[model samples]
Target: MSKKILITDDALFMRVTLKNILVANGYEVVGEATNGQEAVDKYDAHQPDLVLMDITMPIMDGITATRTIKGKHPAANVVMCTAMGQKNMVIEAIQAGAKDFIVKPFQPERVLESIKKLIG
Candidate 1:
């Protein structure tokens, strides 16, 4: 079965792009969120196999959401999405229990590789 994935990004374009990439690569996008709080709620609702979460967002940030999700589901697979130069936040995201990260302007191959590494 295709792995179910949740995508979270404040930008609609980013979410669409990532969804396209995941869908094309044989992953199922189960849910999407524009902020970290919604990401967490969706995560709980869907219990997807993976989450691709943007580091910066309104309402809540990725690191906090990652931490919250990890606290509840220690085995949750999360991959942080970050823009160029957010090194500190990236590191914090890893510490918060994200399994890996993908930098934006996403390359489709990279996105697939990250998801495959975690879910496959």
Candidate 2:
């Protein structure tokens, strides 16, 4: 079965773009969120196979949400999405239990590779 994924980004365009990539690559987008808090809520509700989360967002940041979710579900698979030049935040995110990360200006191949690496 296709892996279920939850995509969280502050920008609607980013979410749409990521969704398109996942759908085209044979994955199912179970839900979407515009911020970290919503990501956590949707995560709990959907219990998706993986979460593609942005590092910066309103309400809460991805690192905090990642930590919260992992605290509750140690097996949760979270991949942080960041822009270039946010290495420190990316490190923090990984420490918060993110499995991996994808830098923005999204690349379909890299996204798929990351997802496959995690889900497979």
Candidate 1 residue lDDT tens string, 8-117: 99999999999998888888999999999999999999999999999999999999999999998999999999999999999999999998999999999898889889
Cα RMSD to the true fold for all candidates? 0.6, 0.6
Pairs in steric clash, model 2: none
**Model 2 ranges with Cα > 4 A deviation:** none
lDDT value for model 1: 0.95
Which residue pairs come into collision in candidate 1? Answer: none
Tens digits of per-residue lDDT for model 2, 2-103? 999999999999999999999998899999999999999999999999999999999999999999999999999999999999999999999999999999
Worst 10 residues of 1 by lDDT: 19-28
